[model samples]
Target: MPATTSLQSLHVMVWTALMASLIAVGSFLSIPLGPVPFSMQPLFIMLAGFLLGWPHGMIAVLLFVAAGSIGLPVFAGGKSGLAVLFGPTGGYLIGFVLAAGAIGLLTQARKTARTPSQTPSWALGLLAGLLGLALLYACGLLNLVRVLDIGWNKALTIGFLPFILQDLVKLVMAVATWRIMHGRGLLPR
Candidate 1:
């Protein structure tokens, strides 16, 4: 590979690893609340997508999951191992990859759009973050129903409804952070 290409690859790898670590740290900072704990993971996941773009963001989320599966204390409340993958929150964990991909794609699309003034970047970023949040909740609710043998209503109440407002806040924060980072030219285009 050319030197520039090799250097770019190295840069991507380092960012991916950092994103994975951030996900783990976010999980560690969770507030235990029954089967589903509130964590800062969604914020990092969205940020990963916005800053790293789609492919690298997905890789980072996958790396985070893989580390947790291997018994690393990188999951919510420092829980890990394969058992966590089969637990109630597992679907949401898996959803992180999809969420990141969606957010990254949306943000990338916005970046490539003609007439940038027609649509503010923050609006696109917010939309992407919200979409990602929706996907996460969908996976979480589905898995909650299956894992807990609960009805949809109960799953919604337990997993989705409680976090809506908090997630919206997180979405705003993620968008704001992305805007600042991009504006400062701290993130790769």
Candidate 2:
């Protein structure tokens, strides 16, 4: 691969910052249902992957986490600081990074990731989005069990079950939005 020109590098940096800001903003729209909150963060997390791919997507998520860790009002319900990172739902925050990376990696594998204006392939995107949710729920459930010192069954009952329908809706929205943006040549590249 050719080295990135200074201008290209600047674009990447700007896009990363923009996407990170979006992820933080996504958290502001939240509903505290139980151990974890329901937020549009998932949509933007997956969108970070769909838009930036791999390292950029992952870094955008990391930037958001770092902001929240340092007293920024960027977490769910505008909560911030290490208390939130180590809190019961912290695993979900970590999962955001993993899911973004996972989704980006999967999207990149399609070869069209860098060329969003190409023909849309929702199949790969759908698969990646589903796996992203799986990973997020797994991390969330494990953390809930460990932090709360509860059983897996109980953790599932409270932590994972309630968000299924809502998350699925978000996933679908992410895919549809990706398609619309891709068709419009609006995805970051």
Question: TM-score for model 1?
Answer: 0.93
Candidate 2 deviant stretches above 4 angstroms? 1-4, 112-117
TM-score of each: 0.93, 0.92
Q: State the lDDT at 23 in candidate 2.
A: 92
Candidate 1 C-alpha lDDT tens digits along 78-135: 9999888888999998789899999988887767664533433776888888888888
Q: Which portions of model 1 show Cα errors greater than 4 Å?
A: 114-120
- Residue 149 alpha-carbon offset, candidate 2, angstroms: 0.6
Q: Return the top candidate by TM-score.
A: 1
Residue 168 displacement (Å), model 2: 1.0
lDDT for each residue of candidate 2 in 90-179, tens digit (9 for 90 to 100): 889889999999998988778644464585678878899999988888888888888999998998888878888888899988888887
* lDDT to native, each model: 0.86, 0.87
